[model samples]
Target: MGAAAYALWGSFPLYFSALAPAGSVEVLVHRVLWSLLLCAVLLAALRGLGDLRALLADRTRTGWLGLAAVTIAANWGVYIYGVQSGNVIEASLGYFVNPLVTVLLGVLLLRERLRPAQWAAVGVGVVAVGVITVDYGRVPWIALVLALTFGSYGLAKNRVGRGTPALVSLTGETLLLAPFALAALVVLEVAGEGTFTSAGPVHTALLVSTGVATTVPLLLFGAAARRVPLTTIGLLQYLTPVLQLLCGVLLLGEEMPPTRWVGFALVWLALVVLTTDTLRAARRRAALARSAVASAHG
Candidate 1:
């Protein structure tokens, strides 16, 4: 399930690319509106409407979800633009950098202390960004925006606290954005720029599929989370970006100049360091638990 989720996420470049002549904003608006409709239907079928209502009643949680909606919307918009503009490799870099960005957010916002290995990993990530920036001859703003917005979205979701069903939370977020999305669609249509009516039925179907494309992976990941260890999920997270990178370079035929290669190599090195530390930490905790159990038995 985890692999399937990541694979679907990684293949998004191909999906978004196929939406050409629609432009990023139009695609994003359709994604938001259709995803909301789908979420509403799923919630009703699952009898989760009560959960959604309860979530909306909480002012604090609703505010956090609102922020989450904004950040994730930005992430989706920037990602669509990147894929549509043939910057798939750079967009892939964003996800590759996201875990590190999350860690950085923890240190800065939560005042969490990082272990030595984590510090080293973050340092390497910074240098990797610098190298990539130089290679691009400008700040890789698309990558940075994607990473920061996604990191912010995660933080906002964390503030909303757990125990909220993923579907419920998503419904709330999309509900918050639905009005704006609807208005945008209307404006686009008034300007004769909307593709929904003008685009052929195949294009319309593909556009509508954006909702399923967005929701299915989340459902898969949610299911996988209940059955897998956090460490396993952490490891699985890399699969999405790795597949995306492959799609960009192999399928899209994007050039990876030597300097860009070196930058990505550094990012990979940092991920290796971070993953090793995570595995070691998980093992230590397991060993401690085993020792405690043994003592209790004795």
Candidate 2:
């Protein structure tokens, strides 16, 4: 299930690319409104309407979900633009950088302390960004924006707390954003710029299917989370970016000059360091728990 979720996520470039002539903004608006519609239907089908109502009744959680909506919308918009503009490789780098960005957010927002290994990993990530920036002859703003918005989205979700079901939280977030998305779509249609009606039946269907495409992987990931360890999920998370990178290079035929290769190598090195530290930490915690249990039994 985890692999399927990431695999779907990684293949998004191909999906978004197929939505051409629609533009990123139009696609994003459709994604938001249609996703909301799908979430509503799923909530009704799964008997989760009560959960959604309870989530909406809470002001604090609602505010966090609203923020999550904004950040994730931004992430989706930037990602769409990147893929449509033939920057799939750069966009893939964003997900590669996202874990590090989350760690940085923890330090800055939550006042968490990082171990030495984590600090080293972050340092390597910074250098990697610098190398990639130089190679691109400008800041990889698309990648940076994608990483930051997603990191912020994660922070908002953390605030909403894990006790909330993923579907319920997504419904709340999309519900908050749906009005704005609807208004934007109306404006686009009025301006005769919307593709939903003008585009052929195939294109129209693909646009609508965006909702299903967005929701399915999320549901799969949620299901996987219920039955997997965090460490396992963490390892599985990399599959998405790795597949995306392959899609960009092999399928899209994006160029990766030597400098860009070096930058990506550094990023992978940092991920290795971070992953090793994470695994070691988890093992240590497990050992300590076992020791405590043994002591109690003895």
Candidate 3:
């Protein structure tokens, strides 16, 4: 499920490019509105509306949901813009950096402690960013924005992940944002700039299907989270960025300077270190658990 979810997300550039006639904001608005409607229908079918209501009734959880909505919307908008602007490589770079960003956020905001190897990984990530910035002779704002927004979004999701059923949380996010999206669509229509009105049946169908594209991966990810350990999930997160990077370079014909590749290499090194540390920790824990059980039997 995790692989499937990340793989779907990695292929997003191809999907978003079809919505080219529309602005990123327009595409995002449609995504929010259609996704909300889809989620609402699913919740009703599954009789999960009560769960959604319960979340809204809880003020703190609701606040986190709102934050998650804003961050994810921002992430979506930026990614679409990146694809449209032929900055898909930069977008891929952002996702590549996200795991380190997420880990740093945990250490800083959640007061979690990192082992030596994890800290080394974080340091390598920082160096990669520096290298990329130097190569550009300016900060890669596209990458930075995508990484920061998504890292924060991930943090927000973590806060409510265990308690909220994935479907309910998804519904809440869409429901919270749907009004604004609908309003945006109306304004665009009034200004005679809406794609929905001007697009052909094929294009319109693609636009409408955005909801399915958005929801399916999330549902898969939710399922994967339940069955997999965090360490394994963490490693799987790399697949999306790697696929996006390939698509950007090979299919999209995006430019990658040798310097940029160097930066990517460093980030890849960091991920290797981090993954090794996580796997070692998991193995140690499993061994200890087995030992404890053996001692108890004795």
Candidate 4:
């Protein structure tokens, strides 16, 4: 399930590519509409309406989701634009950097502590960014924007409490955004610029399919995270960026300079360090738990 989730996300360039003639904004609006409908059905089937209602009723919690919706939508828009503009490599860089961004947000916003190794990993990530910047002669703003927005989304979800059901929260998020989304769609239709109207049957279907493409992986990733350990899920999360990087390089034939490769290598090295730290932490906890039980028996 985790692999499936990452794979779907990694191959998003293909899906988004098929949604041609519609600007990223139009496609994103359609995604919100369709994903809401699908999530609404799933919420109903799972009897999650009560959860949804409670989330909506709690002003504080609802505020977090509202905040998250902004970041998620921004992340989606930037990502779609990146893919459409032949910047998939830069887009992949965003996901590759996202885990580090999340950790940084934890430290900065949540007042959390990090291990020395984790700190080293972050330092390396910064160096990687420097290397890439020097190579490109400009800051990779698209990747940075994507990472920051998604990281903010993660922080907002964390603030909302982990107990919130994924489908329920997402459905409610769509509900919150639905008014603006519907308004945009209506405006586009009136102007005859909407993809659903101008893009023809196949493209229209592809645009609609973005909803399922967006939601299913999220549902699967949530389920997998629940059933799996953080260490395992952390490792699995790398698959998305790895696959995306491949798509950008191999499938799209994007030019990758030697310096760009070096930067990516440094980033990958940082991830390896972080993943090792997570595994070590998890194993240490497990061993301590076992020793406690043994001591009790002894």
Off by over 4 Å in 3: none
Residues 68-168, candidate 4, lDDT per residue (tens digit)? 99899899999999999999999999999988888899899889999999999999999999999998799999999999999999889987779888898
lDDT of 2 by residue, 117-178 (tens): 99999999999999999999999999999999999999999988888988888888888888
Error of 3 at 214 (Å): 0.2
Q: Which rank order by TM-score, best down to worst?
A: 2, 1, 4, 3
Which tens-of-lDDT digit does each residue in 1-298 have in candidate 1?
Answer: 9999999999999999999889999999999999999999999999999999998999999999999999999999999999999999999999999999999999999999999999999999999999999999999999999999999999999988778888999989999999999999999999999998797999999999999999999999999999999999999999999999999999999999999999999999999999999899999999999999999999
In the predicted model 1, the residue pairs found to clash are none
**Tens digit of lDDT per residue, candidate 3, span 28-54?**
999998898899999999999999988
How close to the true structure is residue 138 of candidate 2, measured as C-alpha lDDT? 99
Global lDDT of model 2: 0.94
Global lDDT of each candidate:
0.95, 0.94, 0.90, 0.91
If scored against the real structure, what TM-score would every candidate get? 0.98, 0.99, 0.95, 0.96
Q: Candidate 4: where are CA atoms >4 Å away?
A: none
Provide the RMSD of all predictions against the true structure, rounded to 1 decimal. 0.9, 0.7, 1.5, 1.3
Better of 3 and 4 by TM-score: 4
Clashes of 1: 0
Error of 1 at 138 (Å): 0.6
Better of 1 and 2 by TM-score: 2
Order candidates by lDDT, high to low.
1, 2, 4, 3
